[model samples]
Target: MRAFICAAAFILLAVPAWCGNIRLENKKVRFIFESRHGGLVSMEDLGQRRTISSAGGAPVWEITIGGRKVTGNAFSSFTHRQTAPGRLVMTWKGWPEAKNKDITVTVTVRLREQEALSDWHLAVEGTNGDQVPGIVFPQIGGLQHTTGTNLAVPNWMGELLANPGEQLKKPGAKFEWFYPGHLSMQLVALYDQRGGLYAAADDTAAYRKNLGVQLGADKKLVYYMVNYPDQTPGRQGYSMPYNAVVGAFTGDWISAAELYRQWGEKQSWCRQSRLHGNKVAGWLKSTALWVWNRGTSAEVLEPATDLQQRLGLPVNVLWHWWHGCSYDDGFPEYVPPREGREPFMAAVKKAQAQGVRSLVYMNQIQWGNSTASWKTQHAERYSVKNADGQPASHVYNIFTGKALTNMCIVTDFWKNTYAGLSDTVLNTYGVDGVYMDQTCLTRMCYDPSHGHPLGGGNYWVPNSGRLSDQIRARVRNGKEITLSGEGVGEAWMPYVDAFLALQVSRERYAGVHGWQAIPFFQVVYHPYALAYGNYSSLLTPPYDALWPAEHRPANMLQPLDTAFNRQFLLEQARSFAWGMQPMIANYKPLLATERKEEIDYLLQLARVRNNSLKYLLYGTYRRAPRMAVPEERFPMSRLSIYAGQKDKVTAFEQTYPTIYHSAWSAADGTLGIALASVQQRPYAVDMQLKAADYGLGNSGKIYLVHAAGRRELGSYAGGTVKVRFELAPREVCLVEVTPE
Candidate 1:
């Protein structure tokens, strides 16, 4: 075996070696490259005393060009040179015959001044009808076979791959981000017990290609970029300008997240000022109630008002299925059903009189089949087209058996329609704002006729921002009008006041391996925009009465399954801890139904978030410190509702010590902590609060409040305050610490 290994290494190093080996070092990391093979041999995290590299003979860069597999070993010549202090550049040139013609490829790898990051660029010349498929880093070692090693990717909310080797063997096992869908964010991180590595593609460049991460057959991790086809067939001298940041960190996933956060902050989209000021902030502090009533608009008003009065909290009411046509039956035609405009407007006025804000529903992407505008006028000119030039449509309402063709956001027809809807809802309907559906959730359109990029690129993100600005400009009489969408994406931050944040849940396909869902999105854009829990029974059913028996869809009404009870409460607790506004779906029937205990649980959680709005809504979120606990158990289950066989469900365990705790500091420099017990049984959590941990003096007094009964838990003073507190099942506790 040793002799065979040595022979393979010798064969891989057959090319001329300009420089035998090159070492690039900085204060944080050290990277070693083999010149002859043109591959990274060693990646060392200096502080953690760990090396992340394969056994040997592994190629760092692999590409498929001109129907030929080209790897680092395929290069006939190589040169390594130090361009600047702490920066090294390795260049490789090669020629491969395709269709009896030589295709020249030049690859450059530059280790940037930041020791943890490297930039790879490829240039291809003399291409005669030969296409470039992708470029991949085939082997990133120390990411597999380790006990604590995990892979983190931004999938729905975020995904963590714990059992790397086992996970890779699953069918269709890959993290893909192509344009036009839920791939709003592009980032991946692999970390272990010792340290971790973080990598992210340039978002601007990634739109032209597919960015992804997968595991090879040998169990090594791989990240690759698949280039798009040339617009003009038979074109030559194609230069794919793709760049990535590869870095090493010493802690858990948060350290790697910090790297991406710092990069995102410098982007142009994030720099734009938000649309609304204090009014938006006030809206963020309120809990949102999502109503999908099949009844009259007047029927929704009383329930929304009662819920606000009962909870003593403001509410943002999102009214769905209130249109004149059937549910999701028509788009850009938002006339009220049965009751018509007068009753709908009256309902909105009554809700506002009771201090409740209403937001009418609008579908941002879809042009419904039932609508006359789509059938008679703009389907060809406005609808999105697939790769086969077929119109893109989705079955938004399964029961209706109708499909809605997706609209190209960049088109003048869509812009004008959306702007008109915004004006009608805000001005005519007298609603406070618009709850635009699928605004950030839909995939990018590849409609060539729309005059945007062939596939989705940076166009959609900024265009959505412009639409938000246009709507805000039409706010009548300085009424606090807010704009919110289905989901949160970094690009929509400046435009949107809040996001439904439906991705943060215990559903299937949420993550990989035994991954636990964390506040990764909040860590980046918490104070900038508010996130609300998805409207579902997982938190609280939205209605006051039972679900209408005859009209209920078969899949809509779930069985009284006791198995998910504990998991449901835990998800709600996590939402509050992560600084998101807790929301209830279909509240009218829910409040009048038999689920009184569930309603109480939701109210308690809401009160906790409401009382600590200063810290959670306004202040910046800090990473929850690792707590010492006894026998931590992470449970996994099969998803009851799964689209494919590969889908699996994993439950997040927020037990004592590490119990769903989020720490923050308010504008007044007062440190606060929100903690909760998500289990079915009560738990006594021992907490050690250090003043210095919260940016305070060595000594201080920490005040505690139990949000359930609005009871004061007393104050303790010292440099380190050790306190033991008992919490009821699904109970939340809030603490405020001040330096004395």
Candidate 2:
């Protein structure tokens, strides 16, 4: 028995233990950012004296930053939580071990106030321990493939990380602006497989050789090398050629709270806050609703007139569509007007009179096929060749042996095309703005036939100065143009005012399992299959027309159905739009008719959003009224959205009762409690409102109230209201019981 006990004791002692240790000094404070004059921002109060220490065990850490601490703990990686006013605390636990020691770990916090965009860096020395040195890179991943694969790989081979071997080294790293509010940061720490006294020697020179930084179209921010200990300048890693596949830029210790805050502040319009709208971004102050149509002369004219009649002056709407083969269309061969441009120019005149912004679309590159005489003449000058040395087919000039098209935007042929097109639109049409579509296809051509004498392929390929020069010319032509396209990744951030990102796959959903891994900085609109029943197709022409002309007969009267939880769907869309960044409506098959139910629902939601648009435009947003996910232990039962008080909101249930809950006010009027029903069915909620709720009543308008789609409610003063809803599988109902 004694021998057995001794053996058990030995076994227990030999088992591995995994944990982390963290220490915070008294002088430490949370980092904060604020805006300065001239549309510029700065990071300040970071240099406050602070001490950080850590012990390594597992390779992951739980760090939290907040204005104050709370008794009920929420584990959010390593972020600071705001518990009270003016107090900030950052906490971290469970970090990986560093090199050479039984316990590898060290933590250092830098407090610096910098005016430049990329001004922060951190470095760790070779310490005795088993901790893995890690670095946090900034910037939403680089431009993604339109194929819906979001891997941050570039089009060119040498544009990004060239040698993985040198990535894990002790070479010094630098940070810079890849796009506005997006950063490019790099760090190096040795990875240890075993505990030791001195970490293995790292070839710092090799690591430095691989360093590279990419700026946006415009150099909006200056690059800065942060001064820190244990960092030396040496070329250790290889400088990749352009268009290389760099890994995705995942947020490390830094939380995106500041990004959210800035977005909120920029959303203000008409002196009201509109951040609560379902959709918003870095550009638009709040969500607004109006009809949209393609750029056909008849359609643009009719819709512009109709919208102006209903929505008042300054229509603030869009006239979208390109008359010729669109950017998405298979061909991009530039064709001059079949007629003398009389009809198209007349359409532009009518649209401008009605106060509409007309956006034209066209393929940035030429299709190999020559549909027009001009295109046939310039075939050799424009189209990329296929692997067989033939001109590429379909919409692409397959210069890379791949099916994708490469635009010779810089070639003399392209310059002529653009100049002619600009002249037609600007001088003759008097259009407000130009929408250059699908410039996103700018990439390297791999085919030897289309290769530049200097070896240019995609935008990522190491090239002669030709491609860059062409880009400068297109925008420099003295006409105001709004550049847009799908998957306009970080690589193109600086050039475009709004980013039309394509959230194509299931993996791209903001609610997906690990959605946090991807970031959308500018305004981005996710495209959904309208006919798939997930979203309302009200904005598009009736779905019956969606099928190919030969596929089926049209079904025009689908009797606008509000019963499909249309209200909640709009809310979800609005939320997502604003949540990601600046963006525009991406409804395809641009519809002709106005689905009034959908329009009213969006407009009401917009009314609420408009109130706080200013604050939301420039403010950071937290995923609030917390969304419940499968991985979570507790599914959300109830939700209450608050701006300031409880009085303002339109509450509703759009789905199964199991998915939503009702709310009740507490006795002291200080709290609102939301409860979810256990069963999936219709239910009623009783709410207590404060005049300040949702910034309503403050706006002095009778706020719109809705639940599901059958009913509407309004409130003049703070009071208790009973709300009922018909729940759907997954839906959200916004309430505006207050004024605004």
Candidate 3:
């Protein structure tokens, strides 16, 4: 994090990190940007009486090209002037005629009431239109690091960092989030009790980007976004096709989410139809729990069947590792199943007959180097190549040393084979759907023969989205064949029926602990996509020791002999409260007789969800009212497969409330609120609801909904309605308010 100006020519501006001479304001917010009429400076929400940004910060904008770097003030010339009443245009040029080859950048800033709009354009006139690591524009700096200030990022599901300066400033803390992969969405919120600031790259074209707000050395927060422009050979210029927004609001993270949704709901991808338009199979709509299993029939079937019988709910098991070759080593060589074709097909039929729907797993991006297709199909010709002509490869399985090359899906072979393989799996195995792993995550490719930009371009996202549509339609065959993936992203929402969301509920992994998750994704797209699976964790004591070093967690914490349901109940309750399908992963460990208590709790949650299908599946997810309860500290441990069968693993001191709650509004113009108690004993819950606050209308009747049935509480014409109740251990409590 360098200061405002790094060059000697701009030494005068370096003393005070950020200086602003122009003032822009609306009734709610006051903004001061551009020191000498240039660079973003400070912001204050007048209604909240809080300043969202400080005075010291880095350069407002910067770019890198062909290994040369420059800032907004380092372009050898700079000028700005008012273009309209609330708009300003800034220009920079006069590059030295060396490797620079004469590049220029223009930025247009406009203040629309409470929000600020920043748009950018870059012109390249030389041989250095490549090697653009990233273009940092609309760089906002000087956010004060305080106790209550929090930052929310839209990761796999969503990640809410509490006191980022204190928690995220340590070494190894990940800061940057790249979209269409780790980041499922393009919005983030910086907020506290007073109010919040919302910022997003509101682009409909779906370009890849790095968005983050890190705690710098001085503890000052710096919010920024890295936009990768088209770095094609002989390209001349690139202009932002959309506006980047920063606005001030008077609410929590959910309020910030609604701002993004205003523009998000209108996008072409969502305009096609929301999730309730039956984009998924009829069975998938009512799916309540997902069981995740890998390996052969011996490892998958028995436990999956047991779980389905115990819960008495629709169970969709995502089965992995059925290919003939070893796990993670084979590409599409899926014939002669490892369990023996006859045995495997029989196993699928058995599970289906027992009401267990099977969704087969296949990696979408990788083509194993050890497979025959690598050479016979000429896949090496279309594989993603680095600048040095090496295959962009990844290695996870330790069985074979051969790597898996990321295939370019834009080719006919990649597209046809993916769809063809899925189609065959459904017809042959009589499975429900094909779960494509890592379909939304993309890599930079440099193979010019693929008709894409060398090393970098924005062609991957939209093309992959279209490929999903192709695969879905091919496998359907007039049936409700669903297309599922490992993760969720906005571009693929309209096409894919469901997505596995393990990253949201996993409290600790890869030796890092202390994760606080929020429902930022569901707040915006809960109804647009069906989310399931939290991986094989919680009561499941088995940890894969063969996992790669960087990914293996320190096991030994999950001791089966002294099994406890503390962590299990908390995580499942979170999944239910957040509107995700409650998942029970790796049913082997969960099948232990001592774990019957945990399994029964899962059954209770399933029953509750079964009764409220309309709200959980078809209703809009609303923000949960703030609940402040006493924290319960629990001790948790896990096993390490890579280290040893029994090495004493350090237990992370897990802290969470015993009660988890969520809210939703149904299409029938009613509100539903659910709360679950994960404590071993009992606890009392007291909360008040305002009709106007939750959009429950001016008059409504309150009713209590339990597993057995619904019971009337009372009626309220206006103002607040007080409801108090006590929940038994692992109890799921529901409240319904119907308009009069």
Candidate 4:
């Protein structure tokens, strides 16, 4: 680590005043602060020779207390001193009165020798009755020039805002997991041609409030770190104990992600995934089949068995709408099977015999208004309360106009209800697993009556985990039981064995300014939890027609079927590249239609994914170099042409190597590369590889395995091998390199 000490640069006397400013410099970056206004004057990326802040702009720290704005420049007195060798502390006292309160703000900035990152710690203390609504930081005015720049906002199921301000703005979006709800990786990055800037919080406790980013009317990007501190009429302080890092990197968006990944790897939360070793390898062989039908015992069993036989692989049935009530009509109430418990168990047992596991679906977040108990009992007491003390409601059945009130997971009533329900389901049905819907999808509760804190904290995650554990303990001895959730949530990773990932499909990337969906979540938690890919029914005509009208929500919009099918195939290929299990729902309805090509494509991908289980499923994911291929390879399909749609199908055609590649390595010295083609036509991709690239010697054999069979591509002679192969449309190719 390199260090620069300038003892004589600033006055060392008691007042310590050469100028009312201080500058901190490192090898890669420089930070200049104004003492009078307590604002960041400039942040210079020395390597790029660019400054992120404006000449005389407002400081990065903007505070709002009790609905009143308090700018750092409004403070009456400002003082600064060097706290440590690489650290500086700035304090401001006697701020202008806001919301009838006297306030003080303190900020600490630290820069390390070896890192291009700076850590910031902020504290706001008040002496009167006032509550804090939010805080903004590192206000870079240069972000207004949004020509080549991109902002990345992390969401559950790994969605990002690649084109930030261009998309339709929805303010107050909640980013959760450590703070509450689900999918809280707790990092945001902005990048352009001149490197990038990454900001993140390591402390989950201070991050409990709702966090969001918005493009202000001034065109500057603003961050909202919402907090709900109590308004006590005494000297009280709201302190952020965890340090926030704002770092610069030289590259594109991927480089920004790598910086955050490095910081995330050091946190304790990233290391808690329980799935490792043989457990991860076993999940690769498993495929999930979701059934959403109101049918008799035989109606469900026949199709599940057929899929198992057709695929010639292990399949699991995630049974929905098997109860007596209408689909999603009742919640916290698992009705007895329509035909009877005996027949239900018979169907489950029959499927289990054919290597099919049955998992019952239960709603974990809402209390159905249609339930008989809710009408008679005081269910609102257990529901989530907003800041205004009103219950939160979710409309589940739009046709019938039935809604479910969101429940507070921390309540005793919620815990008892789920515990009893799980016992009945597990012990009575003897199923292999349980699928909990909305387990971590909803926002945190601020209900004061829940016996927890007044404001939201980390109570929701641990309480939800306890509920999952209580249910898992009910499985009979010697029988393996799996716990699955609706979507991926980092806090729920330790409790869930699998996630029905609905966000990994193409529909998530369908808008004009929509982001290019990637498997970032899998890159972090692939070994810990198995993510089952979801397909959009809007893509396949027959599947879309089969959707029940009563079950369809108002927000559901159907895209063109032909264009959807094309993108759907590309999404499946991407999913496989990202180490996710293929999930096909409404199996019976879709199979009855004449969609043989789509079915075959799905089966081939599934077979290949299971076949290359060792590398695709268990190995750690690494970014692979781009493969060179022809520019204009194939023509656009006529199927994409539709009435009232003048837009050219954004799907790639002639692009070289239209294949997604993921590199991996295992502890047993096994090196592997998995590739999935996004192109619709058969094409050959040439890969240039060297043994040293994978930590191998000059002599080694590389085997290319696909549905056709495994064959030796060639051996590396002078430490290099140029392998060429043709992949069928939507085919997955696994290359295994063994050293001699």
Candidate whose TM-score is highest: 3
Instruction: Report the CA-based lDDT of candidate 2 relative to the real structure.
Output: 0.29
Give me the displacement of residue 307 in model 3, in angstroms. 2.7
Q: Compose the digit string of candidate 1's lDDT tens values, residues 1-740.
A: 54554444333423236434557777767777776766766777775777665524456666666667777676565665565666555555554334524455555555555456666656666766555544554234434456566776655455566756566667768766653234445566777766677766655523445556677656666655555544333556556554655667666666666667777666654565252244474554565333333345655566677777767777667676566655555675666444678878888788888888776678887787667877687566788777667778777554455678888777877877788788888888898888888776544556666777555345676677678878888778877787887766666666777777765454422433355565666666566667775434432122112223343433333323444454445556677787877765545644434566666777777787777877777776776555543333434233423121123234443332325787887778777778876656777766776767677665555566565544445555656755566766767777777666
lDDT per residue for candidate 4 within 148-186, as digits (tens), equals: 767665565565555565652566532222344444466
Give TM-scores for every candidate, taking all chains together and pairing residue i with residue i. 0.84, 0.44, 0.89, 0.86
Q: Compute the lDDT of residue 362 as modeled in candidate 2.
A: 48
- Using lDDT as the measure, name the better of candidate 1 and candidate 3: 3
Model 2 Cα lDDT, one tens digit per residue, 31-78: 221111001122211232221101111111111111122111222124
> In terms of TM-score, how similar is model 4 to the real structure?
0.86
Q: How many backbone clashes does candidate 1 have?
A: 20
Candidate 3 C-alpha lDDT tens digits along 32-136: 765542656678777777788864435667777667777766656666555665665666666664365466677766767545333333333443455665677
Clashes of each: 20, 123, 13, 1
Better of 1 and 3 by TM-score: 3
lDDT accuracy of residue 263 in candidate 3: 74
Better lDDT candidate (3, 4): 3
Local distance difference test, each candidate: 0.62, 0.29, 0.70, 0.62
